[model samples]
Target: MKSFEYLRPETLDEALAALSDPDAASLGGGTNLLDLMKLGVAGPERIVDLARLPGLDRIETLPDGMTRVGALVRNSDLAADPGFAAAFPMVAEALLSGASAQLRNAATVGGNLMQATRCAYFQDPFAACNRRAAGSGCDALGGANRGHAVLGWSPACIAVHPSDFCVPLAALGAEAEIAGPSGTRLVPLAEFHLLPGEEPHRATALEPGEIVLALRLPAAAAGFAGNARYLKLRERTSYAFAVVSAAAALRIEDGTVAAARLALGGVAARPWRCSEAEEALAGKPATAESFAAAASIALSNAAPSGANGYKIVLAERLLARTMAAAAAGTPAEMPALPGSLMDDTGEAAHA
Candidate 1:
């Protein structure tokens, strides 16, 4: 086991200062970081604990109707917020769909954003994982590649990011408040995460020592409110990671879709929203046939890895369902594929 220095700074500035160490990593909730540390996947020389830092645990709503979520706020609290759920049901459902209740209670918003990929090869240091160790090559590309990415994947790495919240955030056009060495900056949530190309090690656009202060969810524009849903397809019913998930919001006036937002998870290196899909839905009827057509257009460019071609079909089906459910104010239905796609274990069936 590797040894490391643990620093618990009381103030935000102190915590940010401690994170300036080149080999340091920030710890919030430690649900994800501690596990990686135990597995030797994360070997930080210093851990800057941000759990006790002040001014980052509140969920405040402003006069402009925008909501500011502190990075340290627990997932459970965020999901349980009455105003948040009423205004952004899709985002609330996305948060609730992640992990078990116990784990969600302990995990922070920022920690979830920084959670590493759950690729089998990335978890095992002995395996050839380009994300874990640069230039090591990726074993998932040709072996046990069923759970790998179907979109935004490169030859260097096929791992998909694991985040349910990111899907809704991306679709909602949220922004992140980053505190860095120079000063503070607000970055759109869509641009916060990076797609793994040759540099899979760099999971996020977060610069070294740049601390995430908060996540700001802008108020939905007029006519774009309430009609939204988050649908996650896992190997099992609950408490499992998504094999495919969709976050969808639509404004249907006179039975026609005025505007739409659709973002996908578990299919790409980062949560992805297709402009083509949104465009296809615009000025179209909000019917099942229309939804299916838009979904097909959304994944028109999808290039699935071997064994994961099922994801393309599955994503389209789920996308259509999510759109219908959101329009009806109902939750999405589950497991649209054959029984062979998922078993009792809620894990990918590896060969």
Candidate 2:
């Protein structure tokens, strides 16, 4: 084991001071950070614990219809909040569809937003991964890339973001509240996460020592009496990383779509808001055919890998099914799909 220094800061200012050092990192829930550190995928000389920071875990509603969620809020608590359930069912659904109960209880909102990708190559330090070592070359590009990216990829990296919360946040037009040594600022959820180009190490738009304080979701769209769906298509049914997931909020009028917000996960380097799919759905009849067509528009630009070429087909079917279910106002069971990977616990791995 590698030796490291640990500091528990009583205030955000103290934490910021520690994080000012390039070799120091701030720990929120330590769910992802600690695992990566143990695997030698991430290393920091010193770790600043922000658990003592003031007013970072509160959740409240604003005068507007928007919900303000603190960065330090636990995933389990966030999902169970009555206000969150009433105001943002999509967000709640996304949270509940994530990891096991234990993990959800320990994971924080800030850590969820800042969590690294689940790429097999990137997680295992023994493998040659560009994300772990600069200019080492991405071995995932040609080896076992079934669960990697199909969208927003670059020559340097093709790993996908692994945040369930981020997908719903993007579809709901959530904004991030950030504080740093300089000052505080709000960034749109779409712009908060940086796309992979040449720099795979740089994840978010946050500058050095900047910390996310809260997430502010926008007011309701024109519609949504109870019409929103977050669908995850993973290898298993539940408690697994998504293969090609989608979060869609639709406004339907007279059996036609008036407006829509569609965001995709597990297929892109970031939570991909499919504006083209939204545009295609608008002014079109709310039918299975229309949903399928919209999904086609969403995946038109997808660049599939050698092993994951089937994602394109799976994504379309998942999108169509989710849209149909939402339109019908169906409240599905926790594990709805039969033979789902979510149910394949301790079973033999499928080839």
Candidate 3:
């Protein structure tokens, strides 16, 4: 790892000031940043540690009936918070479905949001990657890219954002609370991540000196609590990144869908929210037919960027199954394996 100056700021102002340096990078829990540093994928001249900053680690309910989650709140803590888990069960499930318990214990909400894509090309310093170095060619385009993006990809970059937490958050319409040199502002979680249109290097909406302070979920998001699910399909049963994942939530009234929220992960540069599918679900019966139709609509615009055409079919089926599971109602208790498919006896199926 490259040597760098470390600055532990006791206040947000100090942290923002330290980040004004063009070569400075913010450190949250260092779960992802540390690994990237070791791989030489990231080498910052200065590290502005936000660990000492106050008031960025609390979880509170706002007066406007929204739940505010501190950016520094640990992933494990957020998933384990009874109030948060009860209010946003799908979000909790997504958190649990992420990395191992030890990593989750150290991973903060902000770190997870800012985590880089798990593209092999982007991680290899010697490889050509537009995301890693703009104007440089993309080797993943002609290389091993079976796991690359199937939606919202361009010739410049075909990497997907690998965040399970952000899928459900995008579905629930969460908002990011950002603090910067220009002051504070709120940005919708769906728009926080930028697509790789041409500037693949600019991955997020954050400015040079901006930092995400927290994430807020409106109270209406809680209405789908009883009927929400996050399902993920990975190459392995554990400690693996998702090949495809879906977060589905529906508010059903008298066997009809009153409202719906759906988002897909591991298929795009951002958590792909299916607004059209959600609209199609409204006023429709909470049945397999309705879910299948919605799922089709969700993947209507999806096209494989490389040899990953299978992902489109897989994603469509997964979304339909996920919506069906949501309509079946959320499990009373979180599954032994949070995002895994369960058998008839309510046990997680090894398959």
Candidate 4:
């Protein structure tokens, strides 16, 4: 095991100051970060613990009906909150679909949003992973890639961001508030994540030493909460990472679609907001045919990898079915793919 200095900060300023060191990293629930450290994929010189920091645990309501979610709020607590569920059931569904009840209790929203990818190559220090070391080749390119991304992936890196909460958050047009060494700033939640473009190592748009304060859910989106659903397709039926997931929120009036918001997970480096699909569903009848058409259009631009071409069609199926269910204001639907695709626990079977 490696050794390092640990600093437990009591204030946000102290936390920010500790992060000014080039090799310092923030410690939240430590569920993901600690695992990476133990695997030798990450070894920070110093760990700045923000567990005692005040103001990051509140789930307060703003005057405009928009909710302010503190970065440190526990996943289980937020998911079980009736008021929070009433306001954003889709987001709650996304949260509940993550890791496990035990992990969720320890995981913070901010920590989850910053989780490293579960790509096997990225997790294996011996493998050539672009995300682990830029300029190093990405082994997943032609290696075992059954669960790799199909969209927004570059030749440099095919790894995807592994946050379930962020998919619906992007569709709802949420905003992330951050505090840094200089001052506070806001970034659109949808754009906060980065694509695996030129710099595959840079995962998020957050500059060094910038800490997330809270996430703001827009007040105007309250109406869409009633008919929203999150569907995750994993190898297992339980806590495994998504093979393909869809977050669908439909606003139907009379017999026609008034508005629609669809975002995809497990398909790209960031949560993929389907603007074209939303536009296609906007005045169409709330039916499966309409959903399928829009879903196909959403995946039209995807370039699937050699071993993952099936994901292009799989994504379309998940998105289309999810949209039809959302339009009917149905309850959450669990993904039921063939059992052979995943092992007994429900994660993808490594070929």
- Model 4 CA lDDT for position 64: 85
Q: 58-176 in candidate 2: lDDT tens per residue?
A: 89777986668898999999988876665666677788888888999999998898899988889988887777787888888888888878888887888989888889788778899
- Per-model TM-score, in order, reads 0.92, 0.92, 0.98, 0.93
Q: List the residue pairs that clash in candidate 3.
A: none
Better of 3 and 4 by TM-score: 3
Per-residue lDDT tens digits for candidate 3, residues 159-245, read: 999999999999999999999999999999988999999999999999999999999999999999999999999987667788999
**lDDT (tens digit, per residue) of candidate 1 on 203-234:** 88899889888998887632355577788899
State the TM-score for model 2.
0.92
Question: Which scores higher on lDDT, 2 or 4?
Answer: 4
Tens-place lDDT digits, model 4, residues 1-351: 367899999998899999999899898899999999999999999999888899899899889887899999999999888888877877888888888889999999888778898999999999999889989999999999988889999999898778889998998888889889999988888888889898889988789998788889888776787577777788778778888888888889987889998999999889899999999899998777788899999999998864898989999988887776566563443223211122112111110
Clashing pairs in model 4?
235-346, 236-346
Please report, as a residue range, the 10-residue window in candidate 2 with the lowest summed lDDT.
Answer: 342-351
Q: Which stretches of candidate 3 lie over 4 Å from their true place?
A: 342-351
Ranking by lDDT: 3, 4, 1, 2
